[model samples]
Target: MVKEYYDPEVKYMLWDDFQIRHIDDLKLKVKGYSDDECKEFDTTEDILQFYPNFKDFIEQFFAEEELVNSSTRLNYLSNYADTKTYSVVATEQLTGRLHVNENLFKPSPKVMEVLHNATYEDVYLYDLTREDELAVEISKREEISTDHILIHSGSSDVIKTVMSLVLNKGDTVLISAPSWNYYKSIVELKMAKAEYYDVVPGKNSYEFDVSGLMSKARAVSPRIIIITTPHNPTGAVISASDLETIIKENPSSLVIVDEAYLGFSEQKFDVRHLLAAYSNVVFSRTFSKLYGLAGIRVGYGLCAPMAKQVFRLDVNPFRVNNISRKMAVAALRDEKYYKGLLKDITESRNFFINEMNSISGVKAFDSAANFVFIHFSENTDVQALKDYLAQNGYLVRLWTEGSRLAMRVTLDRKETMEKVVALMKEFLEK
Candidate 1:
C-alpha cells in the first residue's frame, strides 16, 4: 500500500535505475531507482523478490564514499585531534617537528643536489641498489643482519608485509584496546580477527595488562601480538621484564614490538638482541618521530633471517623510493643531530608535564616519549577546554577513549611550551 525507496543502509540502489545520475559530495541520484519497480526495494529480501540479481545489483549500486567512510570510521585520526595550520601551538602531532626547525632536519639539500645533478638515466632508474644500501645502514644502526631488514615506505608497510606473509583467513592477531588502530584495520582487511587486551592506567603511568594480554593470547592463539613501546597517545613504555614475560609466555605467537618512539624514551632498551635470540620477535622502527623526517616516509623492521626473507618476498619491489632511501641513510649518518633533537624533546616533555601538573584540576603523566599525557578532573569540561585551546590557536590531541578524558600534548620548543602553559593557566583561571 505504501511506496518505499531503497535505503542507503539496507538496499543499495543501482546506477542503471537512474537515466542520469550525479554525486556531489555524499549525495547520490539514480533514475530507475526512482520508478515504481524500485519503490518496493526497501530491504535485501524485497530486492531479491523482484530482482533476480540482488547481490550483483547491490554491488553495482554500492557507494564508494559510503563504503570508505564506514570502513575507516573508527580509524579516523581527526576524531580526537585537529590539524589546523593556523594554530600557534601545533602540538597535535607527536612528530619531531618545531615551528622554527622547518626543513632543518630534513636532508633536502642533499636530495635537491642529487636530483639537480642527476642524468636522464637516474630519473628513469628502477634500481633496488639504493634500497640495499639503506637496508645495510639500518642494519648497522639496529645491530641486525642486513638480511633481516627490508626497506619499506613506513612502519605500517612493515606491519602489512608481516601480516600478509603469516596471516590467513580466520587467523587472529592480538592488539591492545586504544592501541594504534591501523593494526586492527589491516587485520580486518585481511579477513582476520583482532583480539584486544586493555592498557590500564598505572600509579606511575599507563602499563600493559600483561596478565590480561597473556590470557587473551592463550585464548586466541593469535599468529601475531603487537606491542608498542613508548606507546602512542599514552606515552607509556613497557618494561623489559614485562616484555620478557610476554615473549616467553607466547612462544607460539610472533611478537612484534613497535618501537617507533624508543629513541625519545628516557631509558632506551636495546631490543636488537631479541632478533638474534628469538625467531618470532620483530622490532619495527620509523624515522618519522625521532629523526624529524615524517615527510620522507622511511621505516624498517628487524626480524630473524628467515622471516626477513619472507618479508622481502612479501613487500613490493623498490618499495622505498630512491630519494627516501638516500635521506634515510643521511638521517642515520647524522646521529648527533637527531640525538640533540631527542634531548630537546625530553626536556620539553619534562617541563610540560611539570607545568601541567601544577594546574589545580590536571594530572600530567610522566612520559618516556616525546609527548605528555594529561587527564583532566571530572569537574573540568575537557571539550570546552579543547575548544578554548583551538580558539586561541593551540592544537592538541583530545582523547576520550574508554572512560578517560585526557589531552596528548606533543613536546615543542621552550617558547611554544611556555605559551601552552600560559594558555592552560588562563583557561583554568577563567
Candidate 2:
C-alpha cells in the first residue's frame, strides 16, 4: 500500500582500487561477495594500490641484504605518529574545540557581518532561516538555483537524493565500460539499467565510442548519462571536440559528468563552461582523490537552475556536518598544499609513464590523472611478475587477467620516486 521510490544507496559511485570491498562504509559487517582488496579496502587485506603499505615488500626484496636500521624504522614510525593529528576524521571530531584565533569559521568579512546581524532561525544551526542572506551566499557559491548546498552524509546520500528528484523508476542510464565496476551495483539497486560504451585504446589517445554512446542514447529512453574525465582505470580525458558533440546530441538526457579527479589534470576545464551552455548538464565533483578528503566524505554537485528544485527537495539537512565543511573550506583555502601535491603528481606521473614505456612487455595507457594503467605482453608471467616484484620491494597493481601488468601508483616525494623506479627496474630485470 506504500509507494516505493528509487533507493540512492544503490546509486553511489564506486572505486575499484584500494577500498574496503566486503564491508559497509561504517566498516562493521561483511556480505558474501568475492573480490580482493583491489576493488575495496573493506575488502581482503590484499595489496594497497594507493597508499600501499609496501614496507613488507621492501623487507623481502632485500632479505639477503641488510635490513633497514631500527633507528630508521623508528624515524619512519615517528613521522607516521606525527601525521595522526592531521587526519581528516580526527580533525573533524576535534574541529569545534579547535582554536578559532586563526579564523576557521570566518567567512569573507562582508559575508560574516551580514550573518552576524541577521535573524537566525534553525536551519542546520547556521543562519539557514535568514530570509535572504544565507540563501544568496549558498546560491552564488554552490550555483544552487534557489538556495542551500545540500547536506549529505556521504556520496551514497547524494546519489540517492539525485535519483529521487529526477527519475521515477527504470529510466535508462548510460555508462562506459572498464570503469570502476560499481555502476552496475548502483543501477541494480534502483532498477535503472546502463548501456555501456567502449573507449578505443591507443595513441592520439583521447577517443570514446561516441557513436556507440549516441546509438544507445537514442535506442533506450535514456534519462541520465554519466562519464568521467581523467578517467578512472584509464586516465584519458574526453577531447574538447567530442565533448561538444556529446553535449549537442544528448538534449533529452541529463548528462552527469563526474570530475572526481579533475584536480589531477594539468589543464583545468571548468564543467561550468559546458553547464552554462547546456541546461541539461550536471557536474559532480568530489574531494576524495586530490584533497585527501575521501574518508570524511565531502562531495558537491553543480546543476542547472531547473534541476536544483528536485535536488533541494531530495537532500537531507546537516548531513555534511560542521567539521567536514570546515575542512573542505580549509582545503579550498589551502591551495598552497594542493599546489605542492600537484607538482609531485605531475613529476611522478611522468616518471611512471616513462618507466612503463621502457618495460619491454608493457604498453602504458595514456593517463592525465594521478594513476597509470598498463597492458602487458601476451606471454608475460603476470602473477609471478607480481610475486617476484613483491619480493624485490615494490608492489605494482596486478590486474585479474593474464598477460596484463598494470598498477596505479600515487605520488609521494622525489626520493620515493627514485626508490620506486629503482625497485621496478630491478624486478623487471629479474
> Pick by lDDT: which candidate is best?
1
Clashes of 2: 11
TM-score of 1: 0.73
In candidate 2, what are the lDDT values of residues 250-342, reduced to their tens digit?
Answer: 888877776777777774555546767888876666666676666567677666666766786766543455445555655666666677777
The top-ranked prediction according to TM-score is: 1
Worst 10 residues of 1 by lDDT: 81-90
Each model's lDDT: 0.70, 0.57
Tell how far residue 414 is off in model 1, in angstroms.
1.3
lDDT for 354 in candidate 2 is: 81
lDDT of 1 by residue, 298-369 (tens): 898888888887788877765567766777777778767766776677677778888888899888887777
Q: How well does candidate 2 score on lDDT at residue 317?
A: 43
Error of 2 at 148 (Å): 9.0
Clashes (N, CA, C under 3 Å) per candidate:
5, 11
User: Candidate 2: which stretches are off by over 4 Å?
Assistant: 1-157, 164-168, 204-206, 388-406
